[model samples]
Target: MDKKPDHTGYWRTNLKYLLILLSIWFLVSYGFGILLKDTLDNISLGGFKLGFWFAQQGSIYVFVILIFVYVRLMNKLDQKYGYREK
Candidate 1:
């Protein structure tokens, strides 16, 4: 007898959130941090240049936020899909 695969709803939901979070990361780190550095450099935040801060500290902070966001989103998704690892 052949076995059928089980469809886990949580997997798709997690993947969707993961892709979105990563896209935002890429845009902030690569696009704004490097590609638009010149334009950003024209702006200043306090004592630091916008682009420089984004490239160094800003992106890092955003990355941390993204991680947290992903975790939260995943946890919610898991509960919604009845996949929470209680």
Candidate 2:
């Protein structure tokens, strides 16, 4: 017989990972792009200002990669922890 899962533990684990990822998202978008824009303006990426690149392009790419990475990582974690959906 399959054992009942500790739902609270599952939720807690998910919440912990979600919060951490969201915090990093906020930091890169708001912190590096907006809050530190002025400080980063002096820096350049080829011909573009570092902050502008981060705000418009870099963040998008990072976000896409982050999604894939999260999916791959969580799938592995789920398997390792026996929480994967059949």
**TM-scores of the models, in the given order?**
0.85, 0.84
For all predictions, the C-alpha RMSD in Å is 4.1, 1.6
lDDT of 2 by residue, 12-54 (tens): 7777777877788888888878999888889999899999888
Highest-scoring model, TM-score: 1
**Cα error, candidate 1, residue 2 (Å):** 22
Any idea what lDDT model 1 has?
0.82
Residue runs of model 2 more than 4 Å from their true location after superposition: none
TM-score, model 2 to reference: 0.84
Residue 66 shift from truth in candidate 2, angstroms: 1.6
Model 1 superposed RMSD (Cα): 4.1
Q: How many backbone clashes does candidate 2 have?
A: 0
Taking all chains together, the TM-score of candidate 1 against the true structure is 0.85
Output the lDDT of residue 79, model 1: 62
Error of 2 at 55 (Å): 1.1
